[model samples]
Target: MQGAPGKRIAWLPTLVAKRQDTLRAGHLRFAREAPWSGVLHCFVLDCSGSMLGGQRLALAKGLLIALFDRAGASRAEAALVCFGGAGADLRFGPAVPRWWNERWLRPVGGGGGTPLASGVRQAAQVLELSARRKPAQQRWLWILTDGRSSDQPVRPRHADEVVFVDFERAAIRLGRCRTLADAWGAALFAPDELIA
Candidate 1:
């Protein structure tokens, strides 16, 4: 119906039935009934030295703002985490839909070695704490980084969902990060795809 044969199918009863059952028995109904109270999205940003080049940090900031706007429109909660130099800093909050904004996400001056392990550890801690406070809320962690760090910690055990946005170019060779992401069972995306 939408485009070509690959784009649409006239008879998809099995698939539709499966989707309906999933909606009825899974989190979909719950999410729809109480959207604002049902989910929390955490944006974990890497402010390491590598991000200083190519206006990456600026782009990240803009993306964060856009994410906040989208989350707000959907009545979801959001938080911000910046990691690099020293460690991960919980910059914004476990803030509600209305409170998230650019002011909470100021440009973090960067100039030191990347400490990805510390940042991941801190993000896991924050997520754990948030879970404790709001057990019913579904959690989503979005990690944006160049995947250049060598000292990243063991992947967090408590992440309900995790997405890694790789800022590295296609010409660059894969590093430990690909292994790390695979081990963590997180979805990996390219920065160009996400930001552009």
Candidate 2:
């Protein structure tokens, strides 16, 4: 602590040292880095044909950009799992995005059937791996979809929190997103609700 500049001072350690004897720079303790730094935000996006009908996929992409920006600002780790066209795949990372921009999401095309279960399973694997790597870190699972798929996968056990961002805006609502959120005991919000 004597010459450790730019480090946050541990006030408790400093106070204890002051009470013990005359304050000395050697007795001061600088706070160690945070256990996990920030949360791991794993986003599972649906790139099904249905999402393209009303520009839902585009909206989801916009949200992803905003979220990525926020994650960068918060120094949080992020990962992306895209599901559609028969499978799911990880697109981003478990590491912090040092450089994030909307251009990165531009090439994410959308079409085909929604493989909701596949997406959840893929994201679950990512979350499990992250949990093993950083046990102290909080894990948040975010599913951005239109509730167009019939697949209802079990919630990932490792996720500390879950959020379903429903993009469904059809006249005949499926409400699957709400149901899934309810079943998982997670938060449910519409795309508009999130911005509002």
Candidate 3:
């Protein structure tokens, strides 16, 4: 639809969908289905000091590898944003991670503050960019954190769905992840719950 004109026309669906909008110069827009419409899984990981103390970061890394592997098999794309210390950094791509493995994530260390807001903000940027690049592709945000942060960031509006993977294992739980999930209407799961 972007390049080729007069391509395969989804007539009825297009007409029905576009009925609300006014057409220009009585010219109909032909719509063609993307040859491969895949999903993009954006992960926002917390690499804070609290996560490291309980081996939560280690477990989260393991889970990332698994999820990346799944995305590869499904022919989907993935991105990784890691937050710790004072800021958040994009560690991986918004493209298909064909070369994903433990080696790529083994060096992801944990330290400093949780910086949950920074992590979510960085991920929101990624999701917004992905939405522009692949408007038809579905986007899912996966936030893996220990709920050790005091920051409560706004949820990314571009994400079609969101998931909160809680990694809290402390004797005294904060339950911040659960609160975020409830507020955002996102699916909540513990690391163990996901594994099983």
Best by the lDDT measure: 2
- Candidate 2 per-residue C-alpha lDDT over 50-157 given as tens digits, one digit per residue, 9 for 90 to 100: 999889999999988887877777778999999999899999998798798888889999999999999999999999998898888878899999999989899999
Instruction: Write down the worst ten-residue block by lDDT for model 3.
Output: 10-19
Which is superior by TM-score, 1 or 3? 3
TM-score of each: 0.76, 0.81, 0.81
Model 1 residue runs over 4 Å out of place are 1-37, 97-99
Q: Which window of 10 residues has the lowest lDDT sum in candidate 1?
A: 8-17
Candidate 1 residue-wise lDDT, 58-133, digit = tens: 7777777877787777666788888888778887767665866677667566667788887888788878988898
Model 3, 24: alpha-carbon shift in Å? 47
**Which portions of model 3 miss their true places by more than 4 Å?**
1-35
Query: Model 3 Cα displacement at 175 (Å)?
Result: 0.8
The segments of candidate 2 whose C-alpha lies over 4 angstroms from its true place after superposition are 1-37
lDDT comparison, 1 vs 2, better candidate? 2
